[model samples]
Target: MFQKILIANRGEIALRVLRACKELGIQTVVVHSTADADAMHVRLADESVCIGPPPSRDSYLNIHQIVAACEITGADAVHPGYGFLSENAKFADILAAHNITFIGPSGDHIRIMGDKIEAKRTAKRLGIPVVPGSDGAVTEEKEAKRIASEIGYPVIIKASAGGGGRGMKVAHTEADLEVALQTARSEAGAAFGDDAVYIEKYLQKPRHIEVQVFGDGFGRGVHFGERDCSLQRRHQKVWEEANSPALNAEERSRIGSICATAIADLGYSGAGTIEFLYENGEFYFIEMNTRLQVEHPVTEAITGIDLVHEQIRVASGGGLSVKQEDIKFNGHAIECRINAEDPRTFTPSPGTITHFHTPGGLGIRVDSGVYSGYRIPPYYDSLIGKLIVHGRNRVECMMRLRRALDEFVVDGIKTTLPLFRDLVGNADIANGDYDIHWLEKYLAKEE
Candidate 1:
């Protein structure tokens, strides 16, 4: 086991990793930016290091500074708690070169899965079903049109190197394809520095389902069911739940098994998520995140498994603690991302949180890094915390979430609390009759 682990990130996730390390009796050295000197993770860690200034490029994303922290702290391993360098292959390689373990998948897997084009091709080669469209990037308009024609109308253009909905455009008809292609390419170029886009058949009202897979790095793995992250706005997931309301027992079993088998076959290690788009009883591979996801808390709530601990143990050359058959999915779990944004306009709201009172009681879990007086730096993501709840079933879970959301408070800055408050009473939400665009459409109607 790793006696000392350096956490190479900040905010709630960094705190999340810190708690996990404490549970395993491991010492943690949290690396933070100047903006996060008073952050909870930094304050609670066994030791702390200020990597650099507030800007991500010089701090959270600084490879050399992070490596230097590891060297100075004598950390045996580094755990990137999602975002930042979690999926960065070069960072993983650098850690390996320093003889320090990266508590995630091998760099090779990260590189392969990080590229959208290569990942799609790899998924198809692995016998996993993929969306019908061009086999590779369509650099030419003619090629894109041809693929659109063959795949029928209502095609979507996606960046070959994009994620988080950037560089993505949907065309409802042939006439819209040209504009969508151009828009997708331009956005892709600006966001990912790669204008290369691919065409695929777009499913109307698709549900975003992702399987959580964990590998012990020795050809053994397990799948801890799935999460319904379909509740998104502008391609960013806002609310997530484990044991999707859309899937039946058989569907869940089939997809989860396939995801687990693929992880074992590919020799993947640590924690990873295989995301899919489901429509009309069919699942098409979207992509694979080669590190822990932000919504991992929902899976942990339902499965009673500590994913961070698993990742750390596997990276330390330990086998998995549980098998597929030994695992049991207990209840439905839901996670709501509470960001410092306007509930109505969704504009960024960053400042000092003068007052903050998290909800308590049964089935309520709040993972946050800020306190009542903490200043939310404007230089980073607007997310301030996550509220996760678990119940014996979805009904209980929804009700518990409603109560918890009502009790929670974060004053002195606008938050999306009003939005979630609105959702709690919506009938569609109660029935779980929503797709990826459901929240967007709801917001449009409200506007």
Candidate 2:
């Protein structure tokens, strides 16, 4: 086991890793930007290092500074919680070169899965079902048109190296394909420094489902089931739940096995997620997230597994302690991303939080990085906390979430509490009839 680990991230996820380290008797060193010097994670860590200024290029995303911090702190391993450099293959290689373990998949695995086009090909080769689309990058407009025609109308043009919906466009017709292709290529180049784009059949009103897989570097891998992340906006997940109501027992088993086999074939290590788009009773692979997801707490609540601890144990050359049959989902769990933004306009509201109150009692868990009087800087993501709740069943989980959201209060900055309050109360969500476009349409109607 590692005596100490450095967390190369920020916000609630950073605190999440810290708490996990404390439970395992591992010392934690948190790296923060100058703007987050007094953040909750910094104060809670055994040691804290200031990397750089507020801008992510000079701070959180600065690989050199984070590696230096790990060296200076003598951390045996580094845990990247979700964003920033979590999926950067070069960063993982740098840590390995320094003899510091990276608590995630191998650099080669990341490099292969980080590129959407390459990942899709790998998945197909592994016999995993993938969305019908271009087999490789579409460099020319004619190729894009050809691929789009074969895949049918309503195809999505996505950047080969993109995530977070940054370099994506949907085309419904041949005339629209040209503009969509050009725009997608330009956006991909600007966002990821890659002008390559690929086409995929777009599933309208699809449900966003992802399977969480963990592997111990020694040829064994297992999945903890799937999370329904259909509740999203602008392709960013807002609410997530485990034991998706849409998936039946057979579907769960099939997808779980597919995800496990795919990662195992890739020689993947550590924690990763295989995301899929489900529509009309069919599931198609979308992409793979090569790190711990932001909404991983929901899976933890249901499985009672400490994923962070598992990541550390795997990095330390330990095999999976639990088997597939041993893995069990005790209940339904839901996680709401509580961001420092307005529910109506969806604009970030960054400032000092005058009053902060979190919900408690049975089934309520809050992962937060800001306390009362903490100033939220404008230079980063607006997420302030995560509110996770568990219950014996989905119905009970929804009710508990409604109550928890009502109980949460943070003054002096706008939050998405009201949005969740309205969402949970909606009949469609209560009936589990909502899809990816449900929230967007609901919000549009509200206008």
Candidate 3:
């Protein structure tokens, strides 16, 4: 086991990794920007270092400063918690060159899976089910039109290396495809520095599901079932639940086995997620997140597994402690991403939190990085905390989540709490009859 590990990010996830390290008897070193010098993670870590200013490019995303901090703190490993350089392949290679372990997939694996187009090809070659689309990058508009025609209408043009709902455009017809192709290519180039875009069949109202997989470097891998992330807004997940109500036992088993085999075939190591889009009782591969996901707590709630600890064990040359049969899903779990935003206008509200109150008791867990006086900076993501709840079933889970959301209070700034309150109380959500577009339509009705 590593004696010390450096956390290369901040916010709620940073604190999460710190707690995991403490339980494993590993000292933690947290690196923060100038604005986060007094953040919760910094206060809880055994050591803290200031990397740079508030700008992410000079701070959280600065690879050199983070590596220097790891060296100064004598951390044997670096754990990137979800964002920033967590999925950057170059950063992983740099750490490897410095003889420091990266608590995620290898540099090669990250590079391979980071590119959406390449990942699709890899999955197809491995016999994993993938959505019908362009075979490779569509460099010319003429080629894009050809591919779009072959795939039929209602296709999506996506950047080869895009995420977070950016660099994507949906075309419903031939005319829309031609115009969307040009605009998508330009946007992809500007956003991801890659002008390459690919076409894929767009499944309307699909249920967003993902399977979490963990692999030891020695070629052993296992899955932790699936998370129903169907509740989304603008292609971004809002609420995630484990033991998806939409998947049957046979379907779950098939997807889980396919995901594990795909990861093992790729020689993937550490923690990763294979995302899928399910519609009309058919599943299609979307993309794989090469690092821990924001909604991972929901999976942990049902599996009784510490994913962070598992990542550490894998990086330390330890095999998986649990097999496929050992994994058992018990109860339903839900996670709501609490962000600093107005529920009505959906605009960011960054300010000081005058009074903060978190819900507690059985079946409720809150992962947060701010205290009563912490001011939310507008320079980064709006997410402030995660509210996770578990119950014996989906009905009970929904009720518990609603109760928890009502109790969660953060004054001096508007939060998404009201949004969640309205979400959990909806009849569709309560009945587990919702698709990706359900939230948008629901919000539209409120307007």
Candidate 4:
């Protein structure tokens, strides 16, 4: 086991990792930007270092500074709590070269899965179902048009190295393909510094379901069911739930087993999510997140597994603690990503939190890194917390979620709490009748 681990990110996830490390008797070092001088994670961490200024490029994303922090603290491992350098293959390699362990998959695995195009090829080779689209990246306009036409119009152009809805454009017909391709390529080049793009047959209405899989890097793996993240806005998931209301028991088991088997074969280590688009009794592979997902709490809530604890264990060369059969699904769980933003306009709301309150009681958990009088720095993501609720069933879960949302309060700044309150009361959300496009349309109508 590592004597000390450096948390390489900030906000709620850093706090989450810190608590897990404490449980395992591991000392922690948290590095923060100047903007986060008073951040909760820094305040609670065993040791803290100021990396740089507010800008992410100068602070959180600075590899040299992070390495220096590790060297200075004598930390043995780094647990990048998603975002920033979490998926950076070069970062992993650098850590290994310095005799520091990265608490995730190997650098080679991160490189292979980080690229969207290669991930699709790998998924298909592993017998995972994929959407019908181009065999590889289409460089020329002619080739792009040919693939789009062959895929039967309504194709989506995506960056080979992109995520979070960036560098993605959808074309409903051939006439729209040209503009979409150019725009997508331009956005791709600007965001990822790679103009390479691929095409996929766009689904009209598909549920965003992802299977959570963990491996021990030694030919052993297990799955903890799936999470339905269909409620999204601008390709960002707003609400997520475990045991997708859309899937039956058989379908869930089939997908879970497939993902687990594939990870076991690949000898992947730590936590990863195989995301898919589900439509009409079919699952199509989209991408795989090589790091812990933002919505991982819902899966943990259902499986009763401390994922962070497991991540640390596996990264330390310990085999998986639980076998496949040892895993058992409990009830329904839902997570609401409470961002510091305007619920209606979707604008960033970064300011001092005057009054803060979190809901309590059974089946309710709030993972946050802020308190009253904490200043939400504008340089980072606006997500202030996650509100998770679990119950014996979906109906009860929704009821509890509604009550929890009502009790969650953060003053002196706007938040998406109002949006969640509206969603919980909606008939479509209540009955679980929603898809990837549901939230966008709902927001449009409300506007």
Candidate 5:
């Protein structure tokens, strides 16, 4: 087992990894920017290193500096908790070269799935259902239209390396395809430095479902279950739930088995998620997150599996602890991302948290990295914490989430608390009538 691990990210996830390491008897070294020197993860870790200034490019995203921190701490492995360099293939290679274990999948797996287009092809090869779209990247305008024509109208153009809802555009007709192609290409180049773009049949009102998976590098793993992350805004997930209200026993089991098969075929390791877009009882592959997902809490809530602990065990060369039949699903779970932003406009709000209080009761869990006097840095993502609740079923989960939201409080800084307060009382949301576009449209109508 790894004696010490360097957590290579910031905010709540960094703290999340630290706590998991503590339980496993592994010491942790947290890397942070100047703005996060006083962050919760740094405060609790056995060792902390100041990598650079507040800017991510110079700090969290600086590969060499983080690698240097790991070396200085004599860390045997590195745990990238979700963002920053979690899915970065180059980062994984660098760690491997330094004889340090990267607590995720192999670099080859990351490289193959990092490119969204290649992942689609891989999924198809593994007998996973993928959306009908271009066979490869559509480079020219002529080729773009040809694929779009074949796929049907309202096709979506996406960057082969895109994520977080960027580098994607929808074209309802041929005329719109021309403009969308150029814009998507430009956005793709700017965001991922890859102008490569692909096409997919855009589904109207599809539910975003993803399965939580773990592998031991020997083609052995199990799918804990699936999470419903359809509650999104601007391509970002805001609310998530496990044991989606959409799928029943048979449907759930089928999807879970298929996902586990795909992961094993790829020989991937550690924790990952296979995301899909479900419409009319059919699931079309969207993408696979080669690292832990932001909404992983909901899955953990229902399955009682410590995904991070599982990740560590695999990275330590230990085989999977649970087999296919060993896994079992439990009650429903829900998670709400509490970002330090404007509740209505969703503008970034970063400043000193004058007062803070987390809700506590049966089935309530708050994963946070800030304290009452903590100053939220403006240089990174606005997400400050998460509010998760589980119950006997979805109905009770929603009821508990509403009650928890009422008790939760954060002062001296704007948060998405008010927005969640509104959502908790929303009847459509309560009944699980919302889709991927529901939140955006709901916000638009309110505006």
Candidate 6:
């Protein structure tokens, strides 16, 4: 076991990791930017290091500073809690070169899964279902047209190295393909410094479902279950729940087993998520997140697994503590991303939190890092916290969430609480009759 672990991130996730380390009796060193000197994670860490100034490029994303902090703190391992450099293959390699364990997958795995094109190919090679589209990057216009035609009209062009809905465009017909292709390439080049783009058959209405997988670096792995993250805005997940309202027990077992078997065969280590688009009872692989996901709490809520603790254990060569059959899925869980933003406009809200009060009760959990006087830094993400709830069934879970939302309060700044309150009351959301495009359409209808 590692005596001390350095957290190379910020906000609620940093605090989330810190709490996990504390539970395992591991001392923690939290690295923060100047803008987060007073952040909750820093305040609660056993030791804290100021990495650099506010800008992410100079601070949270600085490799040298993070390595230096580890050296200074004598930490033997580093846990990057999603975002920033969590999925960066070079970062993982650097840590390995320094003989410091990275509490995640190996660099090779990260490199392979980080690339969207390579990930799809890998998924197909592993017998995982994939969408019909181009074999690789569609560089030439002629080739793009050929693939789009073969896949039929209504295709989506996506950046090879893109995320957050950037560098993506849809063409409903052959006439729209040229503009869509050119626009996607331009956006890809500007956003990722890579002009590479790929094409896929765009599903009209698909639910975003992802399987949570964990491996021990050996020929053993298990899946906690799946999270239905169809409630999204601009490709950002707004609400997520476990054992998707769309899937049944048999369907869940089939997909979960497939993911677990693949990870076991690949000898993947630590935490990872295999994301897919589900429509008409079929799942098509979209991408793979080689690090912990933002919506992991819902999985944890149902499985009763301490994923962070497992990550540290596997990284330390302890292997998995539970076998595949030993893991149990108990109940339904839901997570609402509580961002500090305008409820209706979705604009960023960063400022002092005058009064902060979190809901508390059975089956309700709020993971946040802010206090009443905490000044949310404008330089970082606007996510202030997450509210996760669990219940014996989906209906009970929804009811509990509604009651909890009514009790959640944060003053002196705008929040998306109102949005969630409204969503909970909506018929579509209540019945779980939504898809990837449902939220966008609902928002448009409201306008």
Could you tell me which 10 consecutive residues in candidate 2 have the lowest summed lDDT? 259-268
Worst 10 residues of 6 by lDDT: 438-447
Error of 1 at 278 (Å): 0.7
Please write out the lDDT profile of model 2 over residues 363-398, one tens digit for every residue: 999999898999999998898999999999999999
For every candidate in turn, the CA RMSD to the true structure comes to: 0.9, 1.0, 0.9, 0.7, 0.9, 0.7
lDDT of each: 0.92, 0.91, 0.91, 0.95, 0.92, 0.94
Considering every candidate listed, which one attains the maximal lDDT? Answer: 4
Per-candidate TM vs. native?
0.99, 0.98, 0.99, 0.99, 0.99, 0.99
- Candidate 1 lDDT: 0.92
Tens-place lDDT digits, model 4, residues 1-447: 999999999999999999999999999999999999999999999999999999999999999999999999999999999999999999999999999999999999999899999999999988889999987888888998888878797999999999989999999988898899999999999999998999999999999999999999989889999999999999999999999999999999999999999999998999999999999999999999999999999998999999999999999998788999999999999999999999999999999999999999999999999999999988989999999999999999999999999999899999999999999999999999999999999999999
Query: After aligning candidate 4 to the native by TM-score, how far in Å is the CA of 301 from where it should be?
Result: 0.8
TM-score, predicted candidate 5 vs. hidden true structure? 0.99
Candidate 2 runs further than 4 Å off: none
Q: Which digits, one per residue and each the tens of the lDDT, describe model 1 over residues 1-447?
A: 999999998889999999999999999999989889999998899999999999999999999999999999999999998889999999999999999999999999999998888899888887678999888888877778888999898899999989888999999887888899999999999998999998889998899999999988778879999999999999999999989999999999999898888888888899999999999899999999999999999999998988888888889998788999988999899999999999989999999999999999999999999999999999999889999999999999999999999999999999998899899899999999999989999999998
Per-residue lDDT tens digits for candidate 5, residues 1-447, read 999999999999999999999999999999999988889899999999999999999999999999999989899999999989999999999999999999999899998888888899999999889999998899888988888888789999999989877789999999998899999999999998998999999998899999888877887767999999999999899999998989989989999999999888778899989889999999999888889988888888998888899999999999788998988888899999999999889989989999999999999999999999999988899999999999989999999999999999899999999999999899999898889999999999999
lDDT of 3 at 274: 93
Q: Which stretches of candidate 3 lie over 4 Å from their true place?
A: none
